[model samples]
Target: MSELKKIPADIAELSFEAALKELEQIVERLDSGQVDLDQSIEIYTRGSLLKQHCEDKLRSAQEKIDKIVNQNGTLGTEPANVE
Candidate 1:
């Protein structure tokens, strides 16, 4: 059996350029509709995984944001700072 190249682990830390290129290929494959049902399903699954990976990365980065920090031990309003 051959190794499947679309594993989330492979793309979880991929650079934006690499991930976007792979995502584009998946979209092209899906758009062409030339693949069999199984292949289509696999492609769709991979696309979803890639989408989730991107979203996870975004969320992880967003988590570091300090939202309305009670800085100086005072309950004051402050803009969230994304570090």
Candidate 2:
């Protein structure tokens, strides 16, 4: 059986931009194929976690935007008839 490695808590706490940047770096390293098998697996796991973090951040931001739009009845700065 393979042991599951834990993702660092700090990664979850990172801003979406920061997490995406790290994920991009990981992709570059993986594409280069310079890492050993074990290192590749480890980084791949980290990249997955980072991807999830970025997605969650995006979702949260979208929810906030939706709330504001619903309250103001506008998609942008201008008011609109939602109905």
Candidate 3:
């Protein structure tokens, strides 16, 4: 019997680059059409999770960048007026 495949639950901990790399690999594999239907579904699910993780990491980084500011002639931080 084939073992059940599993997706990692710690995707949230992966860095932006790592998650993006995994997402790219999933895309390449799906594009190749080498996987069976079940495998395709599983991998597609994983890819979705990876995509969300990458997006969250990017948003967090953007927030940090927006927070950067200059105060009192010295480097400081303030909430950015992001629209």
Candidate 4:
């Protein structure tokens, strides 16, 4: 691997879709076995970060949905008056 180049964008800054796309690309590259061990290690680290970011994004979305459901009384909390 030549000098283990840094990924240009911060993983946290990427939206969930972009991060997942990059992570998928990394998986493809690693699966192809074309990358050198050092490069693989570097990208693997980034992939893990992307995975965690994706998970965090999903968790946040779920929490928001749960709150909405609770407010609507779908999850057993008091329902907001609808009229």
The clash count for each model shown is 0, 0, 0, 0
Taken over the whole model, the C-alpha lDDT of each candidate is 0.70, 0.79, 0.79, 0.78
Candidate 4 local lDDT, residue 35: 100
Residue clash pairs of candidate 3: none
lDDT, ranked from best to worst = 3, 2, 4, 1
Between candidates 1 and 3, name the one with more favorable TM-score.
3
Question: 16, model 3: CA deviation in Å?
Answer: 0.7
Candidate 2 worst ten-residue window by lDDT: 74-83
Could you tell me which 10 consecutive residues in candidate 1 have the lowest summed lDDT?
A: 60-69
In model 1, the Cα lDDT at residue 45 comes to 82
Worst 10 residues of 3 by lDDT: 1-10
Which runs in model 3 stand beyond 4 Å of their true positions?
Answer: 1-8, 71-83
Error of model 1, residue 72, in angstroms: 13
- Candidate 1, residues 1-83: lDDT per residue as tens digits? 64344555677778655776777899999899899999999888878777666655555555544344576987555554443
Off by over 4 Å in 1: 1-7, 65-83
Candidate 3 lDDT for residue 17: 90
* Candidate 2 per-residue lDDT over residues 1-83, each given as its tens digit: 66434557999779889999999999999999899999999999899889878877787776666556643555553333332
> What is the C-alpha lDDT profile of model 3 across 43-81, one tens digit per residue?
998998887777666778768876666688887777654
Candidate 4 global CA lDDT score: 0.78
* Top candidate when judged by TM-score against the true structure: 2
